[model samples]
Each structure stands twice: as C-alpha cells, then as structure tokens.
Target chain A: MLLESTEQVSRWHERRAAFAELDPSMRAEALQRQANSIRRDIVRMISAAGQGHIGGDFSVTDVLTVLFNVVLDVDPHEPRRDGRDIFILSKGHCAAALYATLASAGFFSPNELATFMKPLSDLNGHPANTKVPGVETSTGPLGHGLPVAVGAALGSRIKGAPARVVVVTGDGEMQEGSNWEALMSASHLGLDNLTLFIDRNRLQQGARTEETNALDPLDEKLAAFGLEVRVIDGHDFRQLEAAFGPSTTGKPVAIVANTIKGKGVSFIEDRVEWHHKVPSTEQVEMALEELAQ
Target chain B: MSTLLDTAPVDNRVAFAEELIELASHDDRIVAVCNDSVGSSNLVAFRERFPDRLVNVGIAEQNMVGVGAGLAAVGLIPFVCAAGPFLTGRALEQIKADVAYSQQNVILCGMSPGMAYGELGPTHHSVEDFSWLRALPGLDIVVPADAAQTRIALRQAVAEPRPTYIRIGRHKVPPVSPETNVLERGRFALAREGSDATIIAAGTEVSKALEAAEILAGRGVSVRVLNAVYIAPLDQQAIAAAARDTRAIVTAEEANVAGGLGAAVAAVVAELPKSQRVPMRILGLRDFAPTGSTDFLLDHFGLNAAGLVRAVEEVLNGD
Candidate 1:
C-alpha cells in the first residue's frame, strides 16, 4: 500500500506543522538535512537498481523536499482528499527524487523504495498515478502537467474551492510547445491559484539546454506568456520556500529554480552523463558519505 | 432523394449541446473545455448559461485535452470538446496518457467527426478517429446513431464516469428505430431483424444501413440491421449472434476500414469456429477522399444506402 497508517499520517501532519512554524534559518537547515537524505536515497536507489535519471533527480530533490514538507497541504493518508494542494512531477524522469520525497512524507513505505524499477514493482522508471498514492496524475510525458494545472486551477475557481495547484517541470522541458500553450491559457484565464516551479538544471538528457534548444531568454519568454516570473538559486531552501508563496501578481507564478544537476556530490555536479547514468558501488558510497554532512 | 432521406435529419450536435446543458444545470460538476471552438462545438448556450464554466483554451488542442484531464483529476467532469482530427490527431499522446492511461473521468467530445468538414478537405476530416482511438485500451468509445442515442450516450457517460470518447455527429441523420424504446448498454440496437443477411453500422451510417435493409427487402433480400452504438466494448454478444444467425455479416461506419468498427467485428469473428463464420464486407473509406461536399464524398466512397445494399448482396451471393 502507498500510504502509511492514520497514526503515521498524523505524525506527518505534525512534522509539517512543526516545520511550518520554524523560523527561516532553522527551517532551511531542517530542509537541507532532508534534501541531503533524499539525495542519499537517490544515490543508493540508483546504484542498486542500475537505472535512474540521477542528474535530474538530484537537481529536483530540494524542490520536492520544500513542497512536501513545508508547502503542499496534502494528507499522506488521504492522497485524494478533496481541497488538498495538488502536486505533479511533469519532469517525471526524476521519479527517484519524487519517490524518495513521497516516502519521507509517509505517502508510502520506504521499504518499497528497494523495489525501484524492478520487474512487477510499482516503483517503475516513471511514476504511475494508478499505482502510486502521491501521484495526482500519470505524468512522464513532457509538457503535460502545466496544462492540467491550468485546468485544475480553473476548476477550483469554478467550484469556489481553496485548493492550489503546483506543477514542477524540467527547464529543458520548457522547450515543449505545450508548456507555452498552457502558460498562455493560464494567463488568459488569470489563474492566480496555479504555480509552475521549473527545475532549471541547465541540462537535458543529451546536452545543456542552452547549447541544445537555447532557453537563454527564458525569463522574457515566460513573461511574454504572461506569468509573473521569479528566478531563484534552487539550492537555497529559503529561496525555494519564498518562490512558492501566493501569487500577488493576479496571475500564475513561474518559479525558475536555477539548479546544478547531480548536486551535493562534487564529482556529479553539473555532469551531463548522469542524466540516467548508473553510479558505481564506490561512487555511491562516496556520494552517501558526502551527503552525510 | 430517397424517401429515407426525406425525414428532416437532425444534426446530433443539437442533442449534444441540449443534453450537456441539461446535465450541467442539475450537476455543477459538468464543465466544458474547448480549443476556441465554443461556437462550432455548440457550447454557446452552455457559455451563456454558465460563462465561467466554459474553458476556451485559445486554439490549442494539446493544452485543451491536457486541461480537460486535469479538470477531471480535480473532481470536475470535463467535456473536452474539439474537432475530431485535432482532438484525436494533434494531442493523441495526451489522450493516450492523460485520459486513457490515467483513466481520468474526462469525456472527450469529438465534434463533427467523420468527414463532416467536407469541402475543408481531408485535413479536417475525422475519418481516422475510430482507427486512431479504438487502439487505446479501456476507453468507452461511443458513436451515437441519432439525436436520442446521442442523449443516451451523454447520460450514460455521466452515470458511469469512465474514460469515454463520444463522436458527436455533425452529419444530419434520421432516428434509428424510433420504436425500439430502450437502448441496452454496450449492445447493438437491432434496427431491423431479418435472417438472410446482416448489416452492422455506426453513426450516420446506421440510418443508411437501415435504408439499405429497406432497399434489400424490395430486392427480395431479407437483411438485418444492427446499430452499433458502443465501439470499444463492442457488443460482442450481439455481434456474434449476427454472425451465427445471419447468412453473412457486413460492417459499415463513417470511418476508415482499418481499426474502426469493421476491424473490431473482424477481430471478434476471427475468434469464432470456421464453420460458424460468415463472409464479411468492410465498407468505409479505403483511402483519403478528393475534394467534395459531405454527401458527394460519402456517396463517392460508397458510404451511402446503395453502397450498403450492394455490399450485402455481394456477401450473400459470395462474390
């Protein structure tokens, strides 16, 4: 089963409540600790499974951490409970990071993490909403989540629900025309309840996004699509927390989180090959040791 | 024009818009999403009734479908309406992943399907929708025969909020067996019951099949007509019965002969014992059409009543 018991759920709620009450510095320290642990989980999971997008996973770990622990109002026990803030991992190649985060949040047992990408395991290479509790929708296709986010936000407004819809997409995924289409729709509908958090790790599967598709004027492009853009150092927990605030611009907020792929480990940082490159046993041990800090 | 064509054919889109508005009035969960196709999709009345409920995504089919799936995920019943070719062709992967694979409660409204846009050319023709959509598993693909069946399909969608795709007909068609009081779920409506030969058809082609049965009767060929409503969970029971009971089986649709209703019947019949099997004729477009009006194109491709009767006679004569 995906979710833990009701007791574990209450513990999760209590932990998030406590984290929310923490001052900025202490909250960052706590989040940094959890993000590091999630990164360690990524290293161990990839090394054992021999299949994972380690670069994007590491790059997106902190965003997932901040959203689950402090931002998103989801009940791990009731993943489909109405009025809960919906979170979608559009950049779903980074399922390792999402699985680890959801596990930490008690959406599912950490034991299931051992079955990552194995035959007949629910933890496949990409997240499946039918099998996984925390996944709002089955999203692995690039440029899918944001459009759905727009619809969710619109539906919420139509029903007068106080739910917020947040989706995280890879910066390289921004090259997809559908994202621009969704951005235009969101802006046209004036959806303040929607937030698009982009994991700008500057790398896709084959090459750096700049050298490949060149999203150099990404800020202007987002602004052109009518989103109130906020560029942030994605590694900083405080900035991650700040970028997720309610949109005061009366429009959708685009959080362009500039990050380093394979972050926290010195060797893998910004290295393009680790997009799904399996880590060696020695490399995994060294990575975990560095994350132990 | 044949007396069969004399009946004032109602565009089933009228039934679509009326039923949607009727359903939305009672249940606020019903919201319509279109790709700047509000007027063409017959959603103007819906917009007028509840302006906020109509989501026009500005000429983007991919985003329109994705948004509809998202809306459904968020506990809203979204009727994602778009032109058939664009809805099924452009955002096909979204339809596959977001709606079919995810199994969201999204109702896809493929408006004016099956060569409804005649002069506008093959690019606008949704003749390939059936072949394209039937390949997806677990999607409730329904092609309403006429106005009443159209309403029935809509109500059924709301009752069972499964991943459904309803091909809303823009081609005018007379009601099928107005006397057959109730339509069964996933079962073909046997429009005319005869023992010699059977003609199974869907959408605008159903009425043509019925008329073909009439013409066949005049020609001393006792033909049965089966109105295929549900395409995906094809009434295999009724279909196999037709194959068993009749001398021959001929499948017709306003779609390509590939993966649509005919191919569906062929697959089912291919499972039967060789002795029980009947010779079949799959009638529809084999290739893309040259420029013409809806009637000219359908007739040119032998999608009319005469075509249906000829196919039945050929199968009966083993030609």
Candidate 2:
C-alpha cells in the first residue's frame, strides 16, 4: 500500500530516521535493496502497460533511488515547500523509473503505479509536475531540465534558501545544443547549488551514442564549460552518494554516470533493440527471476 | 467619430519595463530573465534598479526559457524576455515543455514582435509568433495594443499565477483606447462603436485599424473597431456580437493570416448560429516579407489603413 494522504508524509521522516541508524556500508546495502525492488516495479509497470523505455529505467534506477532515499531534502507531503530540494527528469522517457522511485519514496500511493499510461491516469509516459506529487516539472522533450534547474538554483540563491536543484539527462540527450547552452549559463552564473547527472548508458534508441553522435570526452567537454566534472559508476550507490555530495569549489557539478543500458536483466543488457522494446511474457518471467536472484 | 485626438507615439517596452520594476519593488520574488536582450527589451532600467533580480542568461534562449521555468518551480516569478524571434523560434520546445506543459508560472515577454525589426528581414521578425503560440495549451498569449495596455498586461500576468506570453512592442504606437479602459484577461475594449461594420485589430495594427475606420467614415460608412489584445482566450462574445450586429467584419493583425487573430475570429464567427454570421475578411502577411522598413513592409503586405479599407470594401461589395 502507498502512503496516500499528506498527513502520512511523516513516513519520510521515519524512513530517514531508520536509515540514519544504519552504518555506512549497511546504508549502501539498504539503498541497493530498495533499488532492486524499484527495478522490479519498473519491469512490472512497463510490462503491464505494454510500452515503456525499460532499458533507461533500469540504468537510472540506482541514481533515482540514491537521490530520493539519501540526498534530497524533500517531503512528499509538502512537495512545493519553498526550501525543499527540486529534482527534474530531463530524459523524460525514463518516467517509469522516476514514477517507481517516487512511489517507493512515499510521494504517492504505490497502487497508482498500476494505472500508469492508462486513460485518465496521472502517470503518463512523461511525468507531469501538476499531476504527480514530488514532480517539480513536466518533461518529455529532451534537454530542458538542466536549464530549468539553473533557474531554480538562481531562485534559491535570490531567496537565500539552501535548496539544491538536481537534474538527470541521458548520454544521447546531451547532443542537443540546449543542454550546452544551459551548461554555459550554469557555469557563468556560478550555480554551486545545481547538480546534473548524465545517465551515460552508451546506447540510444537505435545505436550507440558515439555511432549516432559522439559524446565521448564528455568530462573534458563539461570541464571546458567550467563545471566541476566527475565520472562515476551509475549503478553503484556509494559512488552516487559521493558524487551527489559536497560541491568542488563554487561551480556546478556534473556526474557522467557510466552505466549499461540494461544493468540487471542479463539477456537484455546493452542490447540496442531493448531501448524501448517490451519483453515477451516468457522473457518477462525470466527477467523477473534474474532480478529475484 | 469626426474628432481625432493627437497622441504621442510611445514604445510599449518602456511601460512593460517600468511596470515590471514597479511590481518587483514590492515583490522581491519577481525576477527578470533575458537572453542578452537587456537593451532591446528595455530592461536596462530594471537591471539598474534591481541588479540581483535581473538574470541575463547570455545568448542562450533555450536555456533562458528553461531557467525561467526552473526559477518558477522554486517559487520565483521570472519574467523571461528576449527578442521575439529567438524567444519563440529558438526555444519553442522549452516554452512548451518547461513552462506550458509543466504549468510553471513564468511570464514570457516576446520583445519587438511582428515586423518591428524593420530592415533586419524575416530572420529577426517574429511574425509567426501568434500562429505558433496559439496552438499551445495552457498558455495565455497577450498582444497589448499600446503602452498603457502593455503595462496592464504585464501587471495582470505578474498577478495571475499562470503561464502567460506578452508580445511587447518595440515599435512606437499611439494609444488606441482610453486610459480608463479596464484591461481584463481575454477581454477586448471597443475603440470605436459603429454598427455598420467592425474592424478587429491587435498589437501594432490597432492604431492603423482605427485610421482605416476613420477613412471609411469619410465615405459615410460607419465602422466599429475592437482592440484585440488577448489573443488566446479571445473575447468570443464580442466576436459573436459583431457578426450578429455588423454588416461585415474585417480582422487585421501584424502577424500571419494562417492562425493569428484573423483565423481565431473566423473560427468563432464560423460556429456562431449561421443567420447571425456576416461576411468576413482576414488581413495579414501571407509570405515572408521583402527587405524594407517596418512601414514599407506593412504597406508591401497591404496591412495598413488603405489595405484594410480595400478589404472591408471588397467584403461589403461581394456580399
């Protein structure tokens, strides 16, 4: 059952308190387990809906889990609180992963997950900020989130609020000139409160990112734009936590999170066709079994 | 209608900037976001008055719009301003997804819209803004007729917690309506009242439309004139009434005939109970304009008083 009402948002505090009791290694392990469950939910969500970007979901699941469970100072109840940290999913194709993570984080009722992409459901293919709690902005088109995050960070600075704005984009998604445009402004304005995580899963819709449009030397490119760059294993919770940690100097942080397109399911891992291809019933069962292990 | 008042030409951007600064004075949450368009957008005074509140995102329009959305997300009212072409053409997707689709309370000010760029050519002219923005859902597109209306539009957009786009004119225009005219959302004021025919005009074309009305009045053909500032949530009541009471309705705009005010008014008049509908004529640019001044282009496209009178006469004669 999902925590439905605003009053039950204290569930976040309880989860935080419980996680605080655990040691560092245990905390990482606990987050890993949470991510594993969320991954299972992603599979079920897309499978039931008969359509989704499952590969990107599996790739970004660990990052979303870490952000919501560990780093972000947000309450599902007061999602619009002036001081709460804001998260934007720029690679909106991975809405399944974001929805599963928000549901797991007690932003809304988990039961609502079953209604995703259905007629009149709040959980569309792209997350809408107005419909879904904890969703700061609606994004389906690529390369929009980072610029908005820059503005949000600026807003926080103007208000003297300590809120941090974080955004996640895809590796293929970086080829869009808008992201670079935002990168320039983000650095020029010195938005230390903004952080960007690129889900560098190597593959795009039909081919490898390099084959489609080269994004290698990604860190150098980001550093050239004056951002503090860090390359980390996207699937590893420890590295994610550290990368999402303190800023380097007064510049914005960019994490080129290296990841496989499909991290958990062995059969589908790194295969270009699985970018948005749904698994067969038998394949679903097999993927579920692999996840169970 | 015989007596005419001489009014000085005023840049709507001045009123827009002044009103914005006035609003920002009391409300610190209001921030001005522009893409290196401070001088053109008339935000120099605003920036000087409140340095921290003015966010110049450089020449990145896409980033400017997205950043405006981001600012609104965290409870700041960002008035995103830029040259009309770049603001609408370069960053249309950001405006769609970040501001409109996400329901961010960001005010997008399209500075120097229509053929206001004059000799700069079609590349700089934002003649397609109306057609492009009218199709987007959850966006209130306002094209203020003159300086006072521009001030009202800015104030209304800031007060209302929703996404709105205002086309602030760089071209100077004389006041077409009284200063006491109550500028409501989606409502138009009657600039001149005549039951014989009605000329519906918006933005910079409004003053010219009134001049056309005066020209028709010289021939003893009375014409009603409506200043259509609110384009998206158009005043259907006024449009329907015009169709019912007037012998003909001629719509004019400094935009394209494809989907601007002409198209909007036609759509309304088409669905109105058939008997009440009158003969209609739409006037606007049909193609990319030739290299010339704003006035030259307006004359070349047949969008001035003479062109409007010709259209109204044609509609009247045809019917």
Candidate 3:
C-alpha cells in the first residue's frame, strides 16, 4: 500500500529477470564483483567529497554489498515495497558505503554518488530517507538504526508481512545505551526474523575502540542479551551469506562481523587516522588499484 | 472567590486513551508505543483492546521514540506515549532526527505534561517541552487544554500524516470551550471575547485564564481569553490582532516562560508595526519549582487565575 503497484511490478520484473536465471554460484560471483565495485565507489565518493568516514565505510562495504546484491529481497525501483526486507544502517557515519552499495544495486544512478555532501544533495554526510529513495530512515548520531529496525520487525509481524529487518551497526556505536535497550526488546519479543550485523572494525574515530571504551568480549555480551550470537569474518562473502541465510530458532541473531577498518586498501586498513579522513588523489588511485586487484 | 476545584474536572489522559482506541479500531495501522509508561499514560485500556498493536519498549525513551519512527517509516502510525519530561527531554535527539527531521508520521503523546508530576519534583515536570520542541523544524506541538480538545486533537493527529507532539494533561480541567468551537492546526478560538485586553493561555493554564477573565470582568475590566491549543504553528494572525485590537496582552501557560507560549506571543507582537504593539506581560514558571503539590506549585509560580489577572493588570498599568 505504501508503494505504487505499477512501479513495483516493473521493478520486480527487472529484478526477477536479473536474478531468477542465475544459479547459486553465479549469484555469489555476481555479488562478489559488486562488493569490489562498491569498495572502489566508496573510495571515489570519499575522495571526491573531500571528507567522509571511509574507514567504517570500507569496513562495512562487503556486508552491504552482500545484503543488497544477494541477500535482501528489495526492489531498487520500488524501495517502499511493504513485503520486502528492511535494512537500516545504524552506524550512519559510514553512509558512503551504503550509498555506493545501494547505487551499485540499481537503487539510483551510480553517478549520483558524486553528489555526496554537496549542497542540496540527497547524499548528505548521513543517509536521509526523505531525500534518498532506498534509505529506510535517517541516521547519523549513532545507535538509532537498531531500535528502528526492531520496530520495523515488530511491525512486519503485526502486519503478517514476509519482510525481514536487518540493521548494520558499528562496533564502537554499541557503546550507546539505546542499542542495549533494543537488544533487550528484540530478544524479549523473540524477533526471529530480525538480524543485526555489528561491523566490528575495532577502530573508532579518535583511536582504537578498546582504548576508547573496550567493547571486547562482545559475543558474550550479545549472548547475555538473549540473542543467538555468531562471529564471522565480515570480508568473507560466503560467511556473511551463511550468517544472514536463515533463522536458527526463536531468538534474534546478532552477527559480530570481525572486519578490519579500511578493508580493501592496504595503507588505510586498521589505521586510526583514516576514520573520517579523506584519501589524497594518489591515495585514491592506490585504493582503486588495490580493490581492482 | 471560586477556586480551580469548583468546576467539574475531567482528565485529558482518559480522553486521549479513548480517542486513540477508537481511532485504532478503525485503522489497523495505528499502534501505541510507550516506554514503560502504560499505567501513567493511561494506555491500559488501549493495550487491553489492541494487545498486538501496543509496543512497550520498556524503560528506554530513546529506543521507544526510534521504534516509533521506524514504525512510521514502515507505514504504521505510531503514537509514542510517555511522561512529558522523558518523552521531550530524554529522547529529544530521536524525536528531532527520527520523527521531526526524518518527517516521519509519528504522533508523540506526552502524558502528564507540565507540573502534573507535582510532588515527584522538577525532574518529572515537562515544563520545558514547549521551549525545547518548538525550536525543532517540521514538528507540530499541540497542547490540548481539556478533554474535548484532547479527543479532537488526537483524532485529527491520527487522520493527518505528520510528526506531532500532543501534551495530554494529567491535571484535571473543566471544559473551557463550547462544542461549537472548531479545532484545527495553527488556529486558536476565542474562549472569551473582550476588547480591554487579551490573555493567551495554553494547556492546563487555559481554564485558569478563563477564570481570570471572569474575575477581571467583575472588576469592569473586559479581557479576551485565547485558548492556544497549537503552539508550534502559532496563530500569528490572532496574536497580531490581540496586539492591534487590545490595550495590552498577557500570555500564560503551565510551562517555562523563556521559550514557550509567552515567548512565542512576544515574538509575534515584536514583529508587528509599532502602532499595533502594546506592553506585554508573560506569566509562567521562570525556574524549577520547589517541592509541593500541583496546586501549590501553580500558586508558587503565580500560574493560577489570580496570576493572569495580576499580569494583565501590570500590562494595563504599563509598569
């Protein structure tokens, strides 16, 4: 009811034609190629914008690509599809990754990524659902997306819709008490259809996350909150796909994706200063080359 | 002298609950969200009627509001009910970003607003909500004065698709406006008409302003009382008319004077031509209230009917 039916049908036709013929291996290969392309786009977006949270963006790129390309049942042309899966980037500072992945998935023209942070641009420093077609909600101040995702999951249940809610959060963003509150409710409500991906890059804006606030032993904390916790290498597309594959049981699943900050680029990976720092022209080329390889 | 207790009083919370339940019965997408405020918000009946629709986020104001925004995003109308202070003060960022800035159609029902939590102290008082929320862009702030207005406002808010904050009064108040008075967005009806001076009041203070108007009438000082239901999209025309037509203007509310109704009225009057401008007096809490009951605190802050009369007299005397 929220979306136009004609637009949805056309978009669904395109998506079905794109994926319906592909076998599982071909789909995985296509998604892997999309992830590399998204990483290159993230580098270009941050470099062109002159400032962005590239570190977390690179850290979350593969996860975003995997979800958008293969996992989430979403239509780019009809972003407001009621029965489609919902994805919220709770750690919204890494909007470059989300925007690039969404664009690569055909939500909008990939050329629009150049408008990131420009005046009157839909691609602001944070993702705004009002301006952007595919963004579920506007998020930037950290620890917001999870709760909204929880609400969406609950809403899907109430409506008896076959939609799944997925929220991607940063490891450092977990320090926000709101996420803990959401974790409590998501477990209490037994939202088996909900999945939260914590991009555990271990590096915050200022310094290492452990030095900042110490979110180690995170799996135990997640398990304590009554979630079915799984730790996976975020860069591994196969692992990411398996984790997001199916609901194991009653409780919701929280996947702690152990990812390196600035994953694809050799010089930028795991570097604290790369948090929101833009890559120089030469550095951008270097990153592109690394991703291309 | 007739006191505030003389008139038969009704709780706006009950009216809000009833109207919400009625609205939800017809619209399946209407959901009630609260942060462990089921009892305080008088949502027991709503929960009982629509158990599946009520989302209790449990002691987390931020999550509750965010969840409300998410629900709105997914095409469900979420009425986020919580105590006034916590709803406005605690989860303000979520209210600003998720609901207001995101332009989500979430109805924020601030329960027990103003000094309703009287003996519970200043921490619980939602006195600064108007000031805090009024600054946000694209958010409607509605403070319904009585039960009838509460019913009307809730029904209207449910029908319209926009982010709104309705302060439902826990304090008892007699219906001040007649059933003929139509309630709309950014419009206020004249509860009492007089040319001598104009008195504007919102929320629980409207009844007190009416009583003050009666008192002023007995003193041969005809005063017009404007019930300010919509605070954000203020009736600038009505406020400007008050300055142009009346000798003086007095703004009153059961909230902080700094950035609330008084400040809103003052801003409008200041923008008018000098000829239309008149001396204005603002009556409300200037600081946090000390320990006391709701009545005691109202008296302590000069928010009673006598307070409006005194403020009007001060503005009239031009002192």
Local distance difference test scores for all models: 0.88, 0.88, 0.87
Return the candidate ranking by DockQ, descending: 2, 1, 3
As for lDDT, the candidate ahead, 1 or 3, is 1
- Which of the two, 2 or 3, has more lDDT? 2
The sequence of per-residue lDDT tens digits that candidate 2 reaches over residues A1-293 is 23445434566567677877888788888888778888889889888999999999989999998898789988887678779998999999999999888877678977888998889888999988888888888888888888888888888999987578899999999999999999998899899989999999999998999999999899999999999999999988778889998687799999999999988999889999999999889988988888873
Per-residue lDDT for A35 in model 1?
92
Off by over 4 Å in 1: A1-11, B1-6, B179-181
Candidate 3, residues B218-264: lDDT per residue as tens digits? 99999998989999889999998888888998988899988999999
Worst 10 residues of 2 chain A by lDDT: A1-10
Candidate 1 local lDDT, residue A218: 87
Query: What count of clashes does model 2 give?
Result: 0
TM-score-wise, the better of 2 and 3 is 2
Per-prediction TM-score:
0.97, 0.97, 0.95
Fnat of each prediction?
Answer: 0.75, 0.97, 0.72
